[model samples]
Target: MKVLPRQRKAVLINSVLGVAVLAGAGGAYSAVTSHSDSSARADARTVTVAKGTVLATVSGSGSLSSPSDAGVNFTTGGKLTQVNVKPGDKVSRGQLLGKVDATAAKETLAQDEASLTAAQANLTKVQEGQPSTSTGSGSGSGGSSSRGSANTAPTPTPSPTVDPAQLAQAEAQLTQAQNAVDAAQRAVDGTTLRAPVAGTVASVSAKTGDTVSGTGGNSTAGGSGGGSASGSNSGSTSSGSSSALSGFVVLTNPSGMQVTANFSEADALKLKPGQAATVTLNAESGTVLNAKVLSVSSLPVSSGSGSGGGGGGGNSSGSAVQYAATLTITSPTSNLRTGLSASIQVVTGEASGALSVPTAAVSGTGANRTVTVVNDDGTTQRTPVTVGLEGDSADQILSGLSEGAKVQLASVSASGNGGFPSGAFPGGLGGGAGRTRGGGAGGAGGGFRTGGGGGGRG
Candidate 1:
C-alpha cells in the first residue's frame, strides 16, 4: 500500500487492460450463442427437396350455368287462358305449353283477309282492262263530251287507261293486307306458347288471367322464332313499338351444361379456349366434372343484380364486375343442377418428374432466388439457385439444385444473410395445401403430345 505514485499508476493500467480483455471475450461468446440460437430455430424450418410432379394452375369460383339458357316470351300479349306446363317439366320442339286469348288475334286475321280480297278485286279489274269503279265516272264524263261533239266515242285509247296512282294504291293495299295477315297469324301462333327446343322448363312467369305483352326481358328486337319468343318465325315487334310481354318460359338444354366463372381482366386474358380444367361442385363434394374451355369472352358478361338463374332461382349478391369465361363439361353430366356453386382450376403449366424444392425454401424473388442448403454436418450454406417454376408449394429447379437436398425456408430480417427466424414453417408451405408447382417457361415450345403433366385439381 505504501508504493510510489509511478508504481501504482503502472499497476492500475495493467488492471484496466485485464478487465477490457475479459469484457471482449464475454461479448464474443454472447455473439456466438446468439448465432447458434438462430441456427437452431432455422433447423426446424428445414424441408427436404425431392423430384415429383407440380401443377401450375389458375383457380376461380363461379356458378353452374346452361350453355343454352333461353327465356321464352309471347309473340304478342293477351289474356293468358291456359298454362299447360309447370316449372321443371321437360318439353320438345313445337310442344305446346299454354295458350293466350286468341279472340283479338283471330279478329285481326279476319280483317286482313277481307282487306286482301278487296285489294285483289280492284287489281284484277285494272289488269283485265275493265275501268276501275273509281275511274269509271271520269271515263263516262269523257264519253258524254264525245257525244256532245256529235262524234263517235273517241277511239278508246289503245293503251289501257289505268290510273297510276290508283294502281299503285291497290298494290300497296294488297301488300299491307298480306303483312297484316302474316302478323296476325304470327300473333295467333304466339298465343299458343310452344317449346323451341327439347329442354326442361326452368321457370314459368305467366299464369291464366294475366295480361301479357309481346316482348320479354330477354327478347331481341327481331324476336325471331328462337328462345321462348320469335322475330322471324313468329314475327316480332319492332324495338320502338314493342311492349312488355308476359307468359315467360325458361328452357335449359339438358345435353349441354357449362360453367360461367369470373376472373380479373388480367387472369381472364391468360386463359384460352380449349384449356383443360376440372370443376368441383360445392354442394356435392363427391362430384367432379372434367371440362375444356369452350370460350373466353373478349368482353365481360353484361351483368345485372344477377337475379334470375337458368334453374329459376339465382343469387342477387356478389355483383362485382369481372370478366366471364366458359368451360364445357365433357364428363358424364348427370345429376348436375344449374346454379350450383363450383370451383374450377385450369392448369396453366405443369411438369412431371422434375427436380424441385419447397417454394418457401427458395428465398428472394425472380432470378435472384437463394436457398440455405443444409449440409450433412448439421450446418447451412447459402446457395444460389436457378428456379424454373415457383409452384404453390414447391419450386421446379432449372439448375443449381439436386434431389434429396435439405433446405431452410427464407425468413431473413434486415440484411439478406440474417438466416431463418424463429417460427413454425414459412409462407404456408407445410400447411397441407397439397403440393402445387409454380412458374411457366414462357412459351417453351412443346406439344400436349410430348410432356406428361400432372392432373389438375379435382
Candidate 2:
C-alpha cells in the first residue's frame, strides 16, 4: 500500500493521455457526420411559388423570303440595248427593266404592213367585180355582116360578174395578212422588258449589248413562294456577261417578306394561323422582327438525316418527319432578302400574373400532376396541383398551390436507387437541383417559356 511519488506521477500522465485520445476520436466522428448531412441537403433544392407570366411556344429554324418575288426577262431574243436597273434598285410595275435591239423587229413589221396593203387592194378589186380587158377576133361569116350593120345597133356590153370563189379566196388572204401584221407588232413590243410588279430589283442577269435568249415566256409575275426566294436565284451576273442568270432580272417586294421554317411534328400540332411569333435573323443576330403564323403545312416533310425515331418514318436510315410553317413578318425591314437564316419562336399559349412553379418541381401528366410541398417543420408532403401554360422553365400553377408556398423539387432516380448522380439526370428533367435563369421557378426575372424547346436562361 506504500506508493512512491514517481509512481503516482506516471499514473496521472497515463490517465491524461487516454482522455486526449478519446477527445480526438470524438471530434473526428462529429466532422464525418456533419459532412454526410451537408451532402444530402445539397442534393435537394427548394423554391417558392410566385405570380408571374408563363409562355408556351414552339420554335424552329428557317429562312426569310418574300411572297412577292418575281423574275423578269425579255420575250424576244436580241442584243440588249439597255439595262435600266441593278440589284437593290426600287422599281414600279411596268417600269422598263431593259431593252433589246428592235431593228429586226421593226423591219419585219414594215414588211408585214406592205403585204397587208397589197392583200387589201386585191380583195377590194375582187369585191367590185372588175373584169380583165382583152382583145377578141370576130367569126368570119356572121362577124362581117354585123360589122356592116354597126349603124343599126351597137353591141350591148355586159356588166362583169363577181366570182364567188375568187371573193372568198381574196378575203381569206386579207385576213392572213392582217394576222401577220399583228404578230409583227407584238414581236416589236416584246423587245422591251418591263417590271411585272413593284419591288426592289434583287438581281440583274444582262446588261447593255448582252445577247439574251429571250426567256420571256417563262417570266413570272413575282408572286410569293414562286420567286427566287429560295436562293436558287442568289447567283448573279454582270452587264455584258455571257453567263446565264437566274433570269433577266430578279425582283422582290420587301413589304411582303415572310419566313419559312420546319418544326417537329409535335410542335407543328400546336402551330396555327395568326399565332404571334418572334423572328431573329442569323445574319443580324441582334435584330428581331415581329411576325405571325401565316400557314402550317398539313403534310410532313420527311428527312433522312434525322435521328431515327418518332412519327416521321424514322426507320433504320435515321430519318425524321417535320412540317413546314410560314410566318409573315408584320414588322418588316427594307433590307429583307430571300435565303437569310432565321430562328422563329411562335407563342402558342400565355398566362400573365399567374401562380407558378419550376417545371422540375412538378411531375406526372395532365390531371395527375403533383408537387412536393416543404412544410415549416422541415417535412415534405405530396400535394396534387393543376397546371396551365406549361413552359420551358416554369409552369403556371392553377390550383392546389399558392404564392409563397415552399416546395421541394421531386427526386428523380437512376440505377434504381434514390440518389442524384452524374449521367443519370438530363438537365431540365425532373428534380436534379440546379438554378435556371429566365422565368425560372424561383421567379427570378424574364418571361417564362415552355413547350418543345430546351431550357436555360432563355
Determine which window of 10 residues in candidate 2 has minimal summed lDDT: 443-452
Task: State the lDDT of candidate 1 residue by residue for 1-458, as single tens digits.
Answer: 67669989999999999999889866755664478556556445677888888766777778776544455677667788988889879887778877778898899889988988888898877666644233223236434444345445333334557778888877888898888887778777767777666677766776788776665223453233323354212322212111222126666663567887877554676688988899999888888889888888788754444331111122334343457788888987666766778998887667799998876576666788788898899788889999886565677988887888888764432122222121111221111111222221111111212221221211
Model 1 backbone overlap count = 10
Best candidate according to TM-score: 2
TM-score for predicted model 1 compared with the true structure: 0.62
lDDT of 2 by residue, 265-336 (tens): 778889999999999998898999999999999998766564321111112343457899988899946877
Which candidate gets the maximum lDDT versus the true structure? 2
- Candidate 1: C-alpha RMSD after superposition: 14.3
Instruction: Go through the candidates in order and give each one's C-alpha lDDT.
Output: 0.63, 0.69
Clashes of each: 10, 6
TM-score of 2: 0.63
Regions of candidate 2 where Cα sits further than 4 Å from its true position = 1-43, 86-89, 110-182, 199-202, 220-245, 308-317, 411-416, 420-458
